[model samples]
Target chain A: MGKNLREPLLKLLIEQKEGYISGEEISQRLICSRTAIWKHINELRSEGYQIEAKPKAGYRLVYRPDRVAPEELIPHLSTTSIGRAVRYQRSVPSTQSLAHEWAKEGAQEGSLYLTEEQTAGRGRMGRIWHSPTHSGIWMSLILRPPIPLNQSPQLTLLTSVAITRALRKQTNLPIQIKWPNDLLIHGKKVCGILTELRGEQDQVHYVVQGIGINVNATESVWPEELRPIATSLAIEGGRTFSRPELIGAICGELETLYDGYLSYGFTPIRILWEEYAGMLGQEVTARTGQGSVKGIAKGLAETGALLLETHTGVQTIFSSDIEW
Target chain B: MGKNLREPLLKLLIEQKEGYISGEEISQRLICSRTAIWKHINELRSEGYQIEAKPKAGYRLVYRPDRVAPEELIPHLSTTSIGRAVRYQRSVPSTQSLAHEWAKEGAQEGSLYLTEEQTAGRGRMGRIWHSPTHSGIWMSLILRPPIPLNQSPQLTLLTSVAITRALRKQTNLPIQIKWPNDLLIHGKKVCGILTELRGEQDQVHYVVQGIGINVNATESVWPEELRPIATSLAIEGGRTFSRPELIGAICGELETLYDGYLSYGFTPIRILWEEYAGMLGQEVTARTGQGSVKGIAKGLAETGALLLETHTGVQTIFSSDIEW
Candidate 1:
């Protein structure tokens, strides 16, 4: 069968999720032979799709493997712009790098880059993020909001709120956000956000928000050093969650929050973030480029800088690594 | 003549600027035949180098072109970092565009991109800047400063001070800076600075500072709409200036100011900018994304935001278009 039929076939199967579709009906709808349908089903199976075939029942999708292909996420997406266009790769060095290139090439707002594995995954401060294949959500989004260049960091905090809300809704795991952007489950790091931007002195041109989530990976996926500090949904929740469903929920929540931000300002995001913050009102030490400061985590400033109450006064931490 | 010998030949001619080098001496120094030396001299002459050739005296460097080639600016440059590595193009759409590309490719700090003309020159707020061939200083510099992302705009203001100081020393044309970055001569804009940056949410990775100067262009360079607002050094000073010399001076001044900025902070830059600012204490209207606000231009905030004293109170304008 033609490669173009793969997406239509997947969509057809998704639309008929309650029942099976006969091979003759699928072949007729796809303008192909039954043998071609059989071959395509085999291809899909190889890509980790579980398709049950019975003599009279024809074909039924039993389960979808943890893949973030557009076809897999399309049916679950509820946002108009967030996932309207997605570039999927089985493996990449970094989705953030690709997102930057696409943004420079004038990619529309809300364009997304999703990868199954990132051979050279990147985290904040140039740290390495381990993204294994078929086990996590490694994605980057391109946003062109009309915000001042200095206020761009608020989007990172806003994204943390979006992801936390989505994770809580999907897995019922008490996911919480650290001061700026790290998402935690059971007091361990589960997600990290890296926000990069290009802009003029006053106006922001585009922002690339990269999110790496540990979804279904087991303990072996992480190195020994990270084994104690890192965790996944399966490890923490004791149940596997669909990667596509999680991505779809995150995108939808982000779109709603982003719209609210554009209309009502950062107050909504700030409130949501404060509610989901796991470190608020706690004594923490923030290590910055200048030096380290110990203070109580009050909340985020209007511009998303962490407001730390210290001995000196109320200090706004623009960028730093936090430890409680 | 081999292209590789061109730079050495030019250097030799420059070293013999007071007198002339014999044809035999030139051929011997450059490791080429006398005939080859003659051909290379002809090529240099075609590139606007006034090489005086005498039967017995040989070749003398009478006058260097207004080009901003590395060789032309090398002798005039006195800085350690700025303009150390030069990328020259005869004609480009915009040095700013090329600078962004080079910055992403790991272009080091102080890498300079100079173009004789910018076919699609840009100004602040997406306006068109007139960059005529061989009559303007059209260049971009890549800088990687270790500063918070919110403080990035200070570099733009610092650059204005650098350019104003340089132009004052070179042309003595009473250059003044408009709020943010427009350099005005006699209330007409003679230079504009466009500062672009790429960075994380908190720290800046790199900044591309694009400076467009209307140097030697006459009244014909400006469009009808820009005629009343634009002026050049030649028109204001009534004499043409060397583009390479101006570039070298500006780069040197920028390096000095940037070093001071990273050490003592934005205080010195703010003090100098306040001195050179023409609109200080004047009533002006700033058109921001939200709306317009009229106020007295008090000065710049600590983070380089325009501090505007309005009837309501002092407002820190992060991004806006200002008019008097």
Candidate 2:
């Protein structure tokens, strides 16, 4: 019922090696009823983890499913509370939409959002993001930074740094971050991040970073035609990688980078992002609202905008869809 | 219903001389129905207008409402399309809240919002705005401009220009716009504006302009002490003005200025706003989140930020609550 209940239960279940635990021990330590423990277990099942239980043997979490659940994920996270609060929804129209609303209604800082499905998910071009129920990780991170609105593009680099570092740390599959907001595997799309901001004149209240990664989704789960162009971690890894582990690692990485940026500016994250951005120094094209322009990518400016050295001059692209 | 529906109805109803007409006439000419006519009529009544009816005499408009409504107010409104789309709620918690939700739902450009009451109104200094039910114009404008995020503060100046023009044109009561976001009546406060932006990295998605004006509210409406610092349009004019008329006029003015900004930019509105800002040359004390400072108001910068010539230098305040 409370956001705290699931967290302690998750830590308890993880520590018990056989995944078998007596309900009595959990009740004595956490000071909750066996019924409360069962309820959270049921909630965890609803969020897609598998548990085997017997009346006499108590409950046994036999399968820690690769799914997004705060309780199962947060305990393993090595974070300084950048994403200390995890809000998970069974299904939402858009993670960014719900995150934006929650941020306005006074959601806490570093609130990490996870949704099993996004019915009306959004992409960069105001297009519908296809989030076929529980097939991928669809979530948004809400960050309230003490920074100017113009400096917000720096957050894109910061998030790329966090996500790229997280993927590198948790998975063996090679993931490359393209300029702006793309993640690719073997040059096929694997993930995308869209950062939206709300502010007072020039002060940014919060940035809702929506990241959708194709995880265990196979070709069958994807739309028929998209199978050729899109991929998931399962396809790339030849096995289903753990979603909770990936999410936990991402939250920790994000927290570390966000804290660093707030304290010391974007220098730390910017350096890391440059390493992961494979499109730097390559022939690139950007599709702005005006029109598409081709240029040699000259890396990013200190402000985090993409520096596209064009035929005329170097243009700082504050926003665009990148192709390299 | 679309906001433009009322403008033609206002003209047609006025031509009938008598304020009363049969529901059949409205339905027949407008190709609507008796039910729709009655529904909109009921809506106009909630906005504080009085109507009378008899079987043979049909319906008679006993008195024009003082509050803002689409029908009576939109007729006199002059603009291409700003006030053309109007939505009104009698007792919403806040107009800004309504506008924000609507914006996400793909509400159109130049949408005009008005509310009779705000259960939780807000002021610049995180203070509660005294908005008695049916006592003030608690409204917000939702705009989706083509400009980048940095150019958004000009919207505040554009909004001030529209509001000041509407107040001057309607009341002859003469009001001045204080730097940042307050509208002054003689010496006391009459209106306030809160501008919030939603952007994509560096591109602005939408801007919600929240405006609260004390129209028909009396001194008694204020908690005993606030009477000295706050005054209403009704008190200043010595007569209750129709809020619907004023609302329509302001929407019209806003549309004009908004169009002016899109076509010609904020230079015109900036010049116009400077004339009404009386503290431009005066020594004033400002309390910001950083601290308090005594400075002379040099003028407004090109981007609509107030240029405060402090002891250190001319600081451009992009976001702050100013009290003079």
Candidate 3:
């Protein structure tokens, strides 16, 4: 069977979602042999699409696997730019590394690299990001923004706003953004954003934003050590959400926010970011390499640096681990 | 006969610089046959080293090629860190590209990628850097600085100071730094520096400083359009200089300046840069993408941006071409 027949067959199945269509009907619609139809059905099954083949009834898509496959996500994606050219992988070491490689080879501005499982997922400061299989969003987005190198930190904050807004639309639970790039819900981290940039002094060549979200993972999926600090959407809401729909929402939100950022500047995004930032006006401690800084988390600077008011003065924290 | 024999024979020739060493004597000293010694001499000649051979008089070293080979440059290098591991290439697309690749693969700090000729050399703001064969220093140095992303432009200014000081020590010609990263002699461009960096918001992964100096090119060596604006050391000084020694001096000066910048801060380097800057206090027009700003070139900011005092106000130019 030709590879081109799979999409047409998928379209036929989706169009006839009411009931199963006969093999003769499918063959007539797709202009292929019954044997070829069966081959494509097996291929779709191997790709984690559950198809029930009865004796009288021909075939029906019984269940769609919880994967961010291009076939599953592309149809639901509403963004015109982001996630348009998706590089879907079943398993990889890190989507950020792959995205960096592709960006070096001149990947498009809005190209996305997504994976089902990350063998060596990484977070900020060389920490391990626990990316379990088929239960979260493990993706990296490549953006070529014509901004100064100093303004790159603001992208992380802007991405935090986008992710938080996307999640807020999907669930009834409250979403709050931690200082730099962590998305928390109910006082536990549910998402992490790591933004890496490569460029010269004045201009940015490309920025890779790697985001890992715990969407559908249950309480039991997290390791013992991480259970106290981490929680997923399923654990908080007691339901498994559609990973494709969630990914689509995130991409659309990010694209809209990113475009606004580039057009009107960081002022709009900064305002939105502060609304979701739960740390502002609260007392917190930032653990830096030098020492610990205890202060009132005043707000974010226009450049997206954390402005903390301590006893000494106002300190601008570029990077640090936060503790309330 | 073998690649190993070339180095031993070259070592013998250097050791016996004042006199010719016979093939039989070289074979006895290095445990190789006379025919093998002759073959290695032919290989050395193919590599652009001029060797004179007379019947029964054996071979003598006549001239060393103006190539930035590891063997030629490493012995003269005095730096403890910079240019420690030199990856010499006869020809490459661009040393910056190669250095970026090596840095991505975890190349050590201070590793250098040097090329004799670049097929696609790059300048600032997508300009074409004319790199001819064996007439300039076309190299990139990798640095891993632990600083904020905003402080990276200071490195470019620091590197400009290093190159100016290095050239000033080697020659009596007056060397002047033009605002950001151009080194000029007699009001014409003699060298250019391009600094590229990769990092996150707070920590830098690596920085590739690509420096190209027009060292030994004659007036005719430059392209017709570039002859008026571009000049080389050989053209200005009326003599060819030793490229290896100049490269060694630049590397040593850069390593010293970089170490000082890391330990103390950008203050020392900024002071040195001001001393070498000739554009300060002069009226110039900065041709930026937005528009042109005509003002007196005041000085550099602590962050290394060019400060211009126009009629309206003081403007900081992040990137632009200067015209006086």
Candidate 4:
């Protein structure tokens, strides 16, 4: 009734910290009857919310399922624009495609599309991105920056820096950003960012930044081939983290950095990115479509290209797969 | 019958040169009954195809409607990849959006979308492109080129060169390319090209090139504001031209130029573009988002950017509206 009053009911239950919220108290807070409150509580219980209900003690939330439901995440998300307008789906092929369609249909600049799992998710150059159900944070954010076409790569770099800072602040694991779009924990990748641009010849219409993080996933989430190089926060930190909380923290950090990027230019983001970068001065090979370039990693160019000190000279890589 | 035999039926009628094909003979050629052939002829007559039937004689094709139907264009088109797979709409808002959606849905690399008219067509920088009904060529072509992101502007320049060459060869009027996106007939804009790129950070997935040419539109087709600036081939050349023929010529030229661009690079197309450029040595002011740059219009950069010789120095303009 009334479009399922479970979200507000769940919000009220989460707000009550110390004790139980009586059925009558919930009815008064939500402006509903006692029978309606009882029904909602039963539905929540069926959905894996361990709510204890007693005759005198009323109702209390004991535990919540490990799900990134909007009802659970909305209460924790604190942002002015980044996560304010969100489209959450239970499962999808890829949030990137959905975000692109929505962006073309006039989705707001900071709209976010969150999915519990991606069946046919993609990485850079059409690589397969493993996104199992209810195990990680798989989402795409739509950004409409009034910048030139050549500078769009900076948005991807800015996003990596934001996510790396968010993960660094949330967990004790040492998160390092491998140029240009990976987050590693002790040399194993914990997250990846793929930023796609749709625009005219010289101006960007919108950008879809797809960020996938193995937050609460364990080692079992990775396939056999990826076991040696893939990792998650739970595997590295030896403890599970809240997916909703991590999503909120990432949205917050991204909003701050994105605002700074728009106002003061990319200098601030570039500096933070250099600090988070872990492969500077290391011998590496960048495999591109043309060939391979082996060199010592120097830094990032002004336009966010990877700068390499090759034997010939300082080379700038626009697209490549890094191997150390 | 059999999905409207008008296309093949029209082809049969056109192949017979100076005389009429007997009704009995037509039925044998098309493997249809004589009554079915008569009914199809009536249907074609109702759709503005003038067929004369004489006593003891057969039907003779007298006149054809001035519509760019696929049935009318397919036989004349001679391209290997371009215009091979086409989607035609009677009316649509914009072919650009439709081509973009189709491209995302795995439409082939050389897919072309054509519309009889665009109710809400768009030009560069989100400007309005007036596309009246059945009077111009409004189409979009999808191309998946394996080129880097910075080189995308060359596609737009290459398209301009192709369209200018086609127009010059078809009509004897002096057709010129106004830098970046517009085609001019004696200094009045006649055609416009808007090339939109959709891709990841460093590589291109596909490019949708929207081309709109005012082929047979009369002077009254333009609004009062655009009357002084806009011109059509019919207005400039003092006679109407076939829209389908122009569309076929454009696709043929574009396919040849695009193939050369992929194999031999942008030098050939750039040379042709410079020859058709009307404002090369003229004094012009480029109004950008930041400010205006007044200079002598020198030429194009290797990357297809407009080069301007200002009093300060040579400035390369990526996006701007030009004023003389």
Candidate 5:
């Protein structure tokens, strides 16, 4: 049997979902032998697809895989450009680092680097992100936006909104965005977004957005120190979610928002971000390198900077760590 | 003698400039044979240094080299760090490209990439920089500054001041800086600077400052189309100048000015830049991608943007091409 028979076999099983289609029917439709169909069904089974085979009843599609492999995600993805080229890795040091290298080597915009596990995952301010094996979405998307350098921070905010919307749709949970790009549920960190840009003053060459989401990690999976501050979807919802479905949702939402941002500027994304923002209208302390500013988080500026109404005046924070 | 005897031989020639020391004296002082001393002197002569050698009167340093080789330029560089690590090349695609690659490979700050000729040199906005063979200074300096991304354009302005001051000392000509970083002598371009940066919103990885100076190009060396707008030092000053000396002066000035800008602030550089600015207080048309703005060039703002007083209001030009 040819290696390409599995896709056709899977498609036949999906098309004839009512009853079991005989092997002779699949062979006649796909122009292959019954041995090829049997081999393909076994390969599909190894990829985590549940298929029931009988002497006369043939194969039936029962369930799909929870993994984020291309065969599983591409069929569900409805985006135009984003996630068109997805590189799946079982393990990597850092998706952001690999995406940066691929971007340097002239990788097209919307190329994605996704890993099942990250050995050296990173967070903002050189912090370490806890990404266990196959328990989270550790991925980076490469984007070449035709925008000025100053407008880049808006994309980070836009990504946060995309992620929040995707999670809300999937889990029906109240997912809120922390200022700048941290996804939180009940004031506990569930996801983190890191945006890195390379460019000149007037133009941006590329922006690599790395997103890490704790989707299926259990309470015991997290360290004792981080258990109070971090929570996962499985831990909070008491049910494991399909990672491939969530990734597809996120990519589709990101492509739509990215296209909107490129066409209409950052106004729409700013509104969406404020809708999901957790700190708006609340007093928070932003700790910067110089000092801390105690103020009420009003909204975002036109350039996506945090607008804080401090005691002195309305101060715009380009970058900082916020705490309530 | 050994291959490392050039510095000692050159030192002996410089020390006894009043009269030529005997070959026996040079050979005994440097712990090398007379034949080895002769070979080292020939090598120095081939490198463009004028050395007077005789059987009775051994060798005297007459003049330094016009080339910007490491052997010649390193000795004259007085900067603490800027030119401490120099990479000299006879030909390259672009110094900026090479410097960027080196910076990605963890090159330290103040590392320099210099070439006598560039086959594929580039300018701002994807323009082609004219870099002929052996008649100009084609160099790029790698810098790792601890500053926000918006403050990077200030470094371009600071580099312009350094190059202008260095040329002022070398030629004593009426040199003026066009808006941004073009150096003009008598309304013709003698130098052009292109600054490319790699960074994020709040941190810079590195900045490659590529400077190309028309130091010794004669009138015929320039293309017929560029003859009216471009002028070289050899044509303007009626004599060839040493490129190594000019490079040394520029590096020293840059190191001092860079340190001052980092420690004190951009106020000092802004003041110096205003003094040498050609379009300040003059009516000019700034052409950008969107449109053109005709106004009187007022001064630079604190962020190094060109501030122009137009009929509507004072407009800050982040990037534009200026013409009178």
Candidate 6:
């Protein structure tokens, strides 16, 4: 049933690569298929894929959806995954939630979870993130680093550097990583990271790094409130870029940073981070649970802690909400 | 069946608290269950409850197993749980392993796990712990702390103070909290802590604290190889201590320490830890995955990261296998 219905449609498209195949030819090739091919083609078009099919000419591949495709991406994909194994969804509540479930089900290292939009996406401090359907890159990567639980915080800092590097290296647009996990393009946020982990008492079992990047999105696609603070590559560069290429670049950068952090502490990554980090050695305020501490950011500590020189002495901030 | 089994057993041992009860009286009080009473008594004896069945005097309750009972241990339990709810097993491969499964099954915060003998108990650095059946407190506490994933290492250091305080207050035996999470009595290992967390992205869903304390083990029971390095409470105090009491005390202390960390930051617990920690201010060397660092153990920073004064400068030690 599956092979016969699509074989004629495939052959017609292959023969007439210039344009669409007539419904009569499609019907004659399979002998029981013109309507079947039309139905299946409609389904494909609904997935943001621009399939131009006319009454006489047949079908034309006008636009391919700018999403991650395994066949097209895997060859150029570097870093042995961190995304090689993938589960893709057109829509989901959040990539982070599904990644945790997969990790619990014994999903191995290098598992990647991708979704078109997050219905209940959240940023650090429980803030809601504006994730519109098919306008952003929403994905989570699962990794089992051979490190203790105490050192997991460094992973988040390291991930931020990787995202910053990828956005810069893969595209001509300038990017800067804000303190914690915000990715900024020319002083406006372009992406954010949320790192999660699961483990057994002091030993880290796995980590899920969720990244959401605003790409190919119009300024109007964001809420009336977010336009001032957020921008997509399409908005900044006047053209939309391929999401799969961006994903490939980020995952490759992340795996490289992970190797550096694992083998040789955070020294090398810190140097790379210092180059792309915003607000370093600048006066900023961090609102932790207790209250707020306004101080000069003194760069990162050796063990990957954010050091802030506060009025009450050099108060080394380990974990908190950073406000510039 | 359950009622008949419990009532007769309770009635037979009501007045005969201090000494043994005769087997015949046990059979008689059980009424339609003379043979049934004998079978139940055998079951009770196997649970490490001391039942002396003297000649014609009947079965007496000489001793009860010194471990937390889900019934008796529930009410006096304090703290927002973190282990207020209880689940126990007589023998299990590992409490941490079982707890991970429970967490997957949506185990609530304060849900606890305990086992009498851990056939495959584990410690930090992937080492095996000597968990001789009913001779120590082998338990795991489930905590759902709402902190960022990276901030979890502080919870490990915070759990150490709780264990140390509970050991001192309940057992009246002084114990030193080793850096990160190890309990030492008279400079010999007696207890260890392993903290695990579950989360996705920025928010931490849960943190499970697994603690093992050697309460009633004798020096002879200690392996000849480990005798020089490890000592149990019985060996240190020259007497057998109650396991249930120690477990209850630890739970109570954990709740308090957790409260302080969540509300007031790690400062309160870090200050208290400074008082009980044996590693602080001492010249020591620690082996982390990255490399070894030798330095004077300063106090913990605000984020629970260990501050070590090495030859170069004050270095923050996150996770390490101590070589003191």
Stretches of candidate 1 above 4 Å error?
A1-64, B1-65
Candidate 4: residue B79 Cα off by (Å): 0.8
- Candidate by candidate, in order, the iRMS in Å equals 1.2, 2.8, 1.8, 1.4, 1.9, 3.5
Worst 10 residues of 2 chain B by lDDT: B1-10
State which candidate, 2 or 4, has the greater DockQ. Answer: 4
Model 5 lDDT at residue A321: 89
**Per-candidate interface DockQ score:** 0.56, 0.35, 0.45, 0.49, 0.36, 0.35
Which ten contiguous residues of candidate 4 chain A have the minimum total lDDT? A40-49
Pairs in clash, predicted candidate 5:
B1-B36
Q: Give lDDT per model, in order.
A: 0.90, 0.78, 0.87, 0.88, 0.86, 0.77
Residues A200-242, candidate 6, lDDT per residue (tens digit)?
4346888888888998888877789998999998888888888
Error of 2 at A136 (Å): 3.3
**Which stretches of candidate 3 lie above 4 Å from their native place?**
A1-65, A287-298, A309-315, B1-64, B294-296, B310-314
Candidate 2 CA-lDDT value: 0.78
Could you give candidate 2's per-residue lDDT for residues A169-216 as a string of tens digits? 777667888878788888888898888988776467788889998887
- lDDT tens string, model 1, A188-297? 99999999999887678999999999998889878999999999998999888899999999999999999999999999899989999989999999999889999999
Instruction: Name the TM-score of candidate 4.
Output: 0.79
| Interface RMSD (Cα, Å) for model 6 | 3.5
**B309, model 4: CA deviation in Å?**
4.0
Q: Pick the candidate with the highest TM-score.
A: 1
TM-score of chain A of each: 0.82, 0.78, 0.81, 0.81, 0.80, 0.82
Report the C-alpha displacement of residue A178, candidate 5, in angstroms: 2.3
Error of 5 at A221 (Å): 3.7
Docking category of candidate 3: acceptable
Error of 4 at B200 (Å): 1.1
lDDT of 5 by residue, A7-93 (tens): 777787888866789988899988999888888888676544688887777778887657777887888799888999889886789
Question: Model 4: clashing residue pairs?
Answer: none
DockQ of 1: 0.56
Model 5, span B150-169: residue lDDT tens: 67889989999999998888
Worst ten in a row by lDDT for model 4 chain B:
B41-50
TM-score (second chain) of model 5: 0.80
